[model samples]
Target: MLNRLFLPSIFALLIYGFWVSAEFKVIAAGVAVFLMGMVYLEKGFKLYTGGLLENILKKTTSTLFKSVSFGLATTSLLQSSSLVSVIVISFLSAGLIGLETAVGIIFGANLGSTAGAWLLAVFGLKIDLSSYAMPMLVFGLLLNTRAAKPLKGMGYILIGVAFLFLGIHYMKEGFDKFQSSIDLSAFHIDGIYGILVYTFLGAAATVIMQSTNALMVLVFSALAVGQLDYVNSLAIVIGSNIGTTVTTVIGAIGANAQGKRLAAAHLLFNVVTAIVGVVALNPLMVTVDEIATLFGIHPHDYTLKLAIFHSLFNIIGIALFIPFIKLLVKWLKSLFNDSYSKEPLNLAKIDESSMERAIYLNPAVLSYPDAAMRALTKESGRLYRNTLELICYGIYFSGEQLRNTDNLSELAENWEKEEQPWSIKGLYIRHIKGIYADIIHFAGALEGNLPRQQAQELFALKVACRNFVQAIKHVKHIYKNMGKYIESENDEIRHQYNQLRLCLASVLKLVDILGVRRNYNHIQEHAAQLKLELHEQDQQTYSTLNKLIRSEQVDSYMASSLLNDSAHVHDACTNLIDGAVIMITRDREEYREYDLAGFTPAAQKTSS
Candidate 1:
């Protein structure tokens, strides 16, 4: 309800303000332009995300200190903590970085964000930045029209900087004009009550603006013009710091649970810092003054003093929180768990409708290449397992029987005494089809949005998914005949079909092990082993069929049926092994089926 009313209420309020005061209109326009500049800046940085930024994150996120340093440096340069937060959230969702490292980055970003306040205070109030805007905008627009991505990214950065300068100039001008017309200082409340009221107003403003940098610049503008007091401005800074988490929280709404946890951690860090800043305002201000002196800052320059205070308080927050990040992560995980968070498998709680969908495949992950690839890989793993289940059920067997049973002959002999059959078609529709479609659709959507190597990875994943689908088709063709002949009166026919099931089962067991035992040698060994065994089974099927035919132990009809079914078994098993190898090894030539390239023909003949 509040969300529904928020936009109209804000619109009405802005309209009323515009009607009443020309100064208010200018200030609001400045804020709007500043926000637009920030958006451009974020976009500019994101165009460069997958290369240097992604590499830096991977290398630096190993330790809390390194993570904090990375966050501080990036935020200092980019001047957008929101951009850093987005990157962190994407990495967290992708399982690229740990929650502790993410929390540390958030802590450092708060400190780094204070650099913006310093930049605006020191330069924005002193210079006529409007003089710098025009040339930047012209160059930016020209480069923006270029086809090259790097040129386009540079263009956005220049344009964004120009708008920021323009916005600051207007805000400074508006505040000067507004101060002459009416004294906002006359309405200021004193001491604790003043701090409380102003802080609440600041937080509300940030929530509406959805930006700390813009809010800081606006406050700095008013402070420079002597329309707002330093003490109240400090309270507002605290409020703005707390309010910044709103952007992080909103960004996480469509993200995975890991992203949400990082969002919560951001809120907690900011709120704690805000609380410390509020409770120890006098002592902290004294500390800020002392720190300002060390840097030769004029004691009367409240704008620089405010910047010092902002950086100091955030540093204090980091000093307080860094030691306990692990405990915090543990608590947050306990509070929130994803449906797919139960480690390797055990995804999809299996609804009453008997339908299943992709678990790791959320839209929020699509913006980042690493996140998107990881999500697809995890979803494909689930698809492989589900396809295995469907194939096993199609042929009158269970995964448990495939893995555990040693006496497959006895199990097959007793098939006639079993209960009624179920439809492989219905089973696939219920479970496998939805998941497969989601995987394929997501991969297709991700195409052209990735780097060259990652795009190749996406293509390999699609091919693996296709292989799984083909395996299902082959199994569906043999399913009916298996059901009919497993109950055959003739023992020889039943035995031959039973052997076919065992052949397929052998491949299933190998694929199943791929999920459990993640060793490199195991993947190579199992893959090569399946190829040789399946080929030997093919030879044995042909040899046994000829013996049964020539001895007239089987009629032509039975012989033809066995021949067709054996070929289907070979094809199905081949597809299963191929798909499993591709999905597990992730298209790496070394780990893939080419590892079986060294198999000897003599060894195959010996196995037969």
Candidate 2:
């Protein structure tokens, strides 16, 4: 288990070592020092989930501006865009903030990343910080051995700082050997091709290393040796911005609709920023050079220029795009639809009537919410299969017969009408709700240092399950009443049944999101829509109850029961939407007022 868990971290370390060079080493060491300082400044994210930070931000002139600033600070310290993105996603899921607010925070993360580049530039220039790095490492290890609280924190900080510098030292050693032997200056470049090649290389390196800081070091190495110039490196930094999105894109693979949508949005933000950098490169470079000259520095090294251009271009990109954020949201919605298929259709399989024999069907019992979500996700997928089979078998209740009809409508109808064993459905529904609660529990068990959005998604899953239960009950009730007075020729039994079915199906679709897809937005919207449908059905139920009572068709006791069930369904749907909304909303006050905190499940009773 330890090996499995640490494998990724080991890979990250190996990659860092492989790609880092001597010029880059100075940059890396500086980044480590700065990161240590940031950890001290924030006191190691004491009130994480961004509450304290969010509060500080809200007091600023603009909430959006504040969020961006916070995002930058947080990401700079964390050094992992994936970690930051997960936090943003979690915040949206937890109902601590809105999607727009989260988006702004993410934008800030891009800017915050320039901190790494600046650190690299600073260290590259100083070239003497290495002497103290070893001392810091030795003292840090000693302090860590003691149990004193403050010393321990400082010790951990020192250790991180030491490793970072050590990594940089090794990296610089690697670069030094190449600089002495290699003659990059002899291989001069034509202007356009030079810029394009180096720029593309920067982007490629960032994508491969998954760190802009690491990529900046590579550029610094080239600058340290008179190989690549500043303007070209800046171009590469610009391209790195675009390339960073590839990780988020890969993370979204096989995710539900919402995850894919957010991934696309992240890609758009980076690519658009890259374009902005391209357009303003010459102007930005001149401005930086003018400043460097004022400070009596030649700015001969293009590495600093790359850093300057990176910060300016990102700021400019944010300035140009911030106001039109809503437009971007709208564009994202238009570009991707829920029905958009990400996977190829599986055609070669068992016959339709042998669905139970299909690999998709299994007898495994679900013990956790994740397990239940997995189960329900598989079950929900049958909706499409069932519908297609119905069409293929000519199973419509209408009089008209199609040219391709083999009169399989009877077969389809029987299959549809066959009452799914109550125990089976009950176990499934129980698992659904169980898994929902488990998700929340698992999130809560996690270290609180995690972002707020992460916690709220777990809660949202719980809400979604509650809503699913109501939908299932409503459908079962309708099925029970179908052959009675509710099913008369003139009655709208079929319509009511259809409403229940749609709500239930929607709930099932949502289960896929919670299962493993991690698409919070897609599940959230669908949850809200399902609730609205359930609400409408409640009204219809009331209307039906009044008519039944007027004609004495349904006795008082039966009418009362039906009304209760209808109301329960309505409430269930409302709860699901509320839970999802809390997951998505930015305003903590809104969720607090709803008191969803009351909805949390009790800890599982352990066996004696």
Candidate 3:
């Protein structure tokens, strides 16, 4: 509803402004062009998102000071606090960085944003930039047409810079011309009332434009043209500072609870900063003037003074809040608890027709490769848990019993005594299929910015999901026959089917242990032992089947069904073990030992 109203209103305002003054139209056009340039500039920077920026972010955010410095340096270089905010939120959602570190980055981003004002005030207004813009636009356009992706990205950046310069030039010219016909200075308010009103206007302009850097550029250009008073400009700066959080808020809308908490922290930080700036407006202005005088800047240079004020207030905000980052994180956690913490384990209550939405995967995290990889890995873990449940229940044993350290034979005996009417297809449709589909869809949606190593990891995860689903299907194939034979009056057939259940259940138990064991050496050791045990079990099962058939205890049909069903069970166990190995090992070095061991299943070795 707000979007519906906001668009038409903006259009109407633009039309009215153009009708009232040709100068207004030129200024509006300049703002439009500059915003477009910002879009291109952000796009160009994204080309480097694959691993370089993500790695730097991961490394730099270890300490609060480093996080702040990273935020400051990144925003200063990019000249877009909104981009920094988005990256911070992405990292937070992906669990790559803690919330306190994310807040620190945001605080530094606020300080770093002031650099744009300084750049424009010190150089943009002092010289004619239009002369430089023409050549930049020419080169940028040429580069944009290049075949290489990086070259094209560079071209877009060049064009963006050219557009920014041209836009500033046009805005200055239009505002200067408008000063002759209309004195915006006449409308300037004084005292607290004026500060509040102009601050709101500043925030509203930024919210509408969705770029504080653009808004600052306009403010500086207007100030240079004598169309905006120094006091009013400061008010607008305060408002713009507060307004910058809108982008992050919007980005967090579809994110997980952690993302929302980070976004809330961002908004809280900015609001506090804005409030302090407004309350201390007079004192800060005096400080800005004093700093200006110390640096040999002319007292009459309001543009430069405004830049100093912008940095000064943000620095004060950072200094005031830096010590309390932990408290802020604690507060945010209390406010927004983890969304998945309370998920019900009742399989019977699952909605069969509902699309299983991704719990960890969100588009907001896609721009940061590290974050994207983390989200995908976490989602895969969720899928594995659900699939584990389905597999356990399909075998007539409850997932709880399989996960526990109880004897598999005892658990299978206890379950067999009851009338277990398990529905493998219903469970697969209700619990497994939806999550598997979601995982596949999320993997397909990942951006190409992921590092090659991370990309391979993602592929491994997808393959794990596939292997798990295949394991379920194999189990489904044997479930009916196992169920019928387990209740048979024939003692030999009933015993054989029970052994099949025990074998599969033992594999499930080992997998449960593998999922929780963290030590690298221990996991590899256990996995090796498990491979041997499964191999021994397969040999024993075949031996028993041959004895029963030779002794005439089982008919040919019974022997054939037992052999095929046993193979299905073996195949399912092998797939589950392979998938577990992939999920547990962190790196190729850890995987090398397993690969060298060449622990192929008997069926595969025999077939080959």
Predict model 2's lDDT versus the native.
Answer: 0.53
TM-score of each: 0.84, 0.54, 0.84
Q: At residue 554, give the lDDT of candidate 1.
A: 89
Structure candidate 3, residue pairs in collision: 50-449
Residues 1-608, model 3: lDDT tens digits: 98899899999999999999998988998898889888888888887666678788878888999999999999998889998888878777766777888888888899999988988999988898889999999999999999787998899899988988988888888888988888888998988999999999999999999998889888998898788889999999999988899999998988778889978988888899999999999999899988998999999999999999999989998988888888888888999877454453445344445435567777777765666877788777777787777776666666766766467776666664444443788777766787788778877778365545666667767767887999999999987887688889999999888888888888777777767874556665666677788788879978998899899999999888988988888888878877877777644453322221244323233434
| Ranking of models by lDDT | 3, 1, 2
Better of 2 and 3 by lDDT: 3
RMSDs, each prediction? 5.5, 13.1, 4.9
User: What lDDT, from 0 to 1, does candidate 1 have?
Assistant: 0.80
lDDT of 1 at 87: 70
Question: Which segments of model 1 are wrong by more than 4 Å?
Answer: 341-355, 389-431, 451-457, 476-491, 508-543, 546-564, 577-608
For model 1, how does the per-residue alpha-carbon lDDT over 213-253 read when each residue is reduced to its tens digit? 89998999999888998899999999998888888898788
| lDDT by residue (tens digit), candidate 2, 1-608 | 87577669756875675476454444445445544544432332332323344454355315777778877887787665655665454333333345566677778888988887788777843475457678987887887777655676677666666655555554555555656655555555557677667667767767766666666666666666666656676778888887788776765564434445667777888888887667766777788888677766655756666677778888888897798988877776677674323242222221222112111111111112232233233433332232222221211221112222343333223333322233324433323333444434443444242334433433444454454444434444444443232333434444443343344334433533343454544554555466666767778778877987799766686666566545654554454444334334322332323224655422101110
**C-alpha displacement of 418 in model 1, angstroms?**
10
**Model 2, stretches more than 4 Å misplaced?**
1-62, 93-95, 139-156, 254-258, 294-296, 338-608
